[model samples]
Target: MLEQHATELLRHTVEETFPLAREVMTLDARQYTCPERFAQEKQQIFSRVPLVLAASCELRKPGDFKTVEVAGIPVLLVRNREGTVHALLNACTHRGAAVASGCGSAARFTCPYHGWTFAQDGDLVGIASSTDFGAVDKTALAMKRFPVTERAGLIWVILDPDSSHDPADMLGGIDELVAGFGFAGWNHIESRTMHGPNWKLTFDAHLEFYHVPVLHRETFGPERSNRAFYFSQGPHQRVVAPRGRPGDTAKDDLYALGRLPAADEPFDPLLVGEWILFPGASINTFYLNGQRGVLLSIVLPGPDVGTSTTTQTFLAETPPDEVTRAAMEELCTFLARVVGDEDLPTSALQQKALATGLLEHVRFGQNEGGLQHFHRWLDDLLKADDAELAALLAEPCPQR
Candidate 1:
């Protein structure tokens, strides 16, 4: 059972607080970098749960389709004539050849190796030599399909047919948390993908603001202070740091560098809000004056252990003008570079050490309460017997 105090605190923070307080803490890195644990995590995290497979933006119109690889399974996502999004196994039933090549508009997909075709809805439509086969049941040979659902502008897929789980239930407290940000009206402006040492390692680097004063001194150091940082945890974990006053010493350098616009009005008081959604999504909010924008990052497991991909989406209330858009792009690019150039190397190095038995376990601190909560959830899932796991999957998300 979830502790009563933790559950209450989560409900209040996610529902009531706009900029909540921060608690300093740390998480043991050993669990993530360990090879034996990584194998267990694959079955627990990737196979047992539904994951975001594609974005709705990729299949915005009928006949549009996109192909993606999910944990080594080739997936084809298509928008049928009725406009519903469907996910299908990409293999042709004839000889398991992939029916489609790249993202494009297609009423139907035809296998090039042999002449087999399937409709956008996964109906087997053709066979190269029907006469050669003696009354083969075409309906029985239709391409396989996977369960898919769309929410918050992204498409989610369940790989295991026998696994009983509800996507909404798995989303936990994120629905209310996202609704609180008024994101329904926001438009998707851009998306970028980056290769990382490990998805969880990259997430760990972003889960706390403790690194800002030290690791990000060259970039955000002048505009932010360690004392201004605050942390909160619930179903979602958040760390916030307000920009210092205009005339503070830290402000002079940031202003002189022309990175931040001169404070024409009082600081909006909400400078930065970083939220870590359970499982593997991170949402960030940035406030300059009264202008605000949100960045959402989703990390997914790749084909094997030690590899993963991070997909980021930038969104805003209004479509940005060239200048504003450029700034936003630059901001995301800089952050991506920091992760790729700095964090990835360290994480990879740690993975190597862990593989060689150099590290056994990692510890978490009080401020890193969010990390602790996340690991606890992981451990719970891993340790759960089959019966307990099923019960967890069936339970409804806690009410706000």
Candidate 2:
């Protein structure tokens, strides 16, 4: 979907690696904040990447469905009577109107525009006037469907007509990384969306642990050490930070910090794991033994400059013990606040600078290797010739 010229620029900008010790990384500023580049990314990144689009599980039973948008394309996710998940264009074939308005369970969808109806399986079950239409092939009029693949408890979709890559293949090392956390049995909890700044900025904020000690000082400052952050590579980049031990504090202050009973009660050490899928998907997992959870987020491009949306879904072990579920909910709420209240505002400010054109480039330090790897990957994607890009995009889906 990216323009030819912007792809060329992205290729040219990402050709060099900035060394961080023995690790080589690349950083490209234009790709992040440039309007033309952003447009190109919407087409190439969001459309071609299955991991960004297809991911779902049953909220209830058969006939359950949810509607979502990717990059700007409206999508309807439905579980048919057979319990197989299907991703279909949300638009009605009748007049291109969205068939379903919101997320809910439905036996069938009828277009408000013309009374054309579709079964839960996306088949055209009724035409307002079948006999009057005379020999119109209803089977051929089924809702346009996209490719959907389910893996590791998530459903992924590919929107591009020419996309030949499998979501699992593009996921590369992320498959094993996710397995390391035992995510297959995780249950869906809640999801929230935040709008501000570009999605890339939100992802950039998560790609490093350097900001943890500073940005999270009020909550985690006393317990965490900045130097403890470390990174590892797979299909994507991963950063792990060990939770810090709480320091001396008054009893009331301890209660306010969510640490009760006593300071010496020996609380579980926290582990924050982050995954940066090539392009712009970020998944952050937090472990606290009884309070394990994961946050899957995507930075989807809007229709203008300096704008993007962040959609986050929180999942935990389902059918959980009441206490564990309650605790996980509280923790997820807290994390969402940290992102909505703290990180987004800062990212918006960064977008302001990017739009003003006063800054041509942003710098990355040795500690931000994940950020560099993401940029380099983007460079490779944009620079690749159509054939090469197609090959990279069409890599076979990993076996579930």
Candidate 3:
């Protein structure tokens, strides 16, 4: 975040502490309910734009790899023996069967269909029954690769092979703001997937703190203010909530941390709140048993507008001690309850209501600038003309 932006937000926070009427934003219901729009989004926005695919820590070392699907395209990400990351189509060169699934450290991957093997760099190294199968150029058959750029301990990939946009152009130096979080040194603890309705609804929930006092009442508690300070780089954004209550007497373990930070200590506020790495990923802070933890929220869009998936990854700055490990486990369980019990269930109901078409559009308050900015960015891409769209795609897309 720029110093000017930070100061401006602080000023707003101070002013908004009172009961002031703020401008509100209207959002269309079909944005979440229409299948045709979803399909278009899958093609024009999701496929063409550079998305934050994973935290660089997910591939910790040489030969470490993870597989994910983006815009319904199977992606294989690997760090080669020389420590470079490769993002390639997970399809096998032989028959298009995925050569890998999940995460692990593997010297090479072999297609299960016919046992064709490839190294981490997608080099075809072995082919079974060569005499009978005939000879082909192995180099020509390397797994189809995608455009992948890495910066600030994060990996971004464009799902469309033909798209030439750079992820750094999407980031536009926003990485410098949160690079201080030490994500590069964070150790990935665990990942669990859950189903949700509409990627936008789920993402919208993460972008604002407005629902905290109500929806998260049992989790975040009512005393905490339901407000957020917004900072964005292009379509990517970061929402900062107040770090902790200085003099409160509540035991609110928000972020699923079993305890709160000592309010007396001089602390940095920017590192304290939620960061949305847009398209799908959030970096949130947590402190459990006195050890720092980061909750990496990766939102995976499902086959249609009606469904979506979320991958919540827990990370620690260092390997946790037994006590800290136990605290983390407890935090994980609490997070499951909060999301599965509170968040997604409500989003599913919201989806159901939106599908009724009774409401044409909903509103977002002035404080919800992040959500407004996101929708506007989406609309711009979806509504751009031929030449305008091409030029938009070619340039850096950090939102003003």
Candidate 4:
């Protein structure tokens, strides 16, 4: 499916407004600035959604773990000795202190505030001065757990403790699409976090190509195309834009196949594109000295409407060699500069400007279908009653 569409996308990009949508849509600027709406979204969008937390390769071994705070909820994502990833509340059951911080392999997480220890599975296995406690119920003291699904090289979690939402519920058949890239086999190269504006504003940077040639021109080159081809599956979106001139399909077997070139392929060319996991995540292909790398990223909301934190992780088919390491560092440095020096600073200013109440509405053209899909779904979910939400949740996602 991607191959067929990629071929079509390459052909389409030769023309202007290559993949136009049905209509232009305008959103109220409040969608970017209203604190009340932002509060509702924290529940309807961020809390309820199955969020992509990390790549599977980031937790390939037993005891491997990573921690993140999503929408102000601290999460401890761990791979147990059984080789299953689980999302547990980072707070200790004893005194409500954080049980862990950062990422690494650990035998058990012991709270820094106290000596309370928890296994990767969230079992409250040890407590300081147990004799003094006099028969506390260990089972009842277990760390709260959230639903998690590890699929297609990604770890997804629904922050709700009792959530039934699986990765399939949010991703539809997108996991099948991602599985083709073999991200699980890739070696982790870099992982870093950056501060940004409101979560939505930071996210808006990932949804369209309208600013690509202008905002990213210094890094992306002069011939980069502004036109984008968008493919939406339910609330998620995929974006394809021109990297350079389209490849000659008949000139080689790889291009003829209309697929993204493999890591070892002599040439890494633009073919199939990038993805936006609904809410605030993105999976994109990267090139480091002509070698292929994969990036998985997420923008997380902070304590309120005005602040956000972003984490980006890069991986390669294998651990980098000396020359490849230099290339990887150069590519990552360039990405950091373009995002920090360019995209993020501008988005942060947009957030500040939106809060001034000067503009009541903002417009989105056909080119911004990704943003439209997100905000529209948010509106629908916010207006829904519990029953309505359940029925909507049960509705089959459009895989095509």
Give the higher-TM-score candidate: 2 or 3: 3
Where in model 4 is the C-alpha error above 4 Å?
A: 10-17, 242-271, 384-400
Candidate 3 C-alpha lDDT tens digits along 126-159:
9999889998999999998888887878888878
Tell how far residue 223 is off in model 1, in angstroms. Answer: 5.4
CA lDDT of every candidate: 0.63, 0.63, 0.77, 0.77
Best-to-worst TM-score order: 4, 3, 2, 1
CA-only RMSD, every prediction: 7.3, 9.9, 4.5, 3.5
Cα lDDT of model 1 by residue, 1-400, tens digit: 1223223334444465333224443445566665677778777766665566655666767999988665567889999999898888999998899998667899999998888889998999998888986678999998887767777666667665455665555555444444445554566667777776666776667666556667667766555554322233333555444342345333222222323333573222222346665567777765323346677777776666677777777776566777777788888888777666676676677667665656666655555545555666677778876566645644443321
lDDT of 2 at 225: 46
Which 10 successive residues of model 2 have the least lDDT summed?
1-10
Candidate 1, run of 10 with poorest lDDT: 250-259
Measured on C-alpha atoms, candidate 1 has an lDDT of 0.63
TM-score to true structure, per model: 0.75, 0.79, 0.88, 0.89
**Model 3 RMSD vs true structure:** 4.5
TM-score of model 2 vs. true structure: 0.79
**Evaluated with lDDT, which candidate comes out highest?**
3
- After TM-score superposition, the amount by which residue 344's alpha carbon in candidate 2 deviates from its true location, in angstroms, is 0.7
lDDT by residue (1-400, candidate 4, tens digit) is: 5555556655654443365656888788887777898889888777777788999899889999999998789999999988989899999998899988899999899999879999989999998999987799998999999988877788888888876556455556667666777777888888889988888889887888888878887877656767666776666677766444344232122334445566676333432566887778887776555566777778899878888898988888777788998888777777778888898999988987888999777877877776777678778778876545545644535422
Q: Which stretches of candidate 3 lie over 4 Å from their true place?
A: 9-22, 246-267, 384-400
Taking the candidates one at a time, how many backbone clashes does each contain? 15, 12, 2, 1
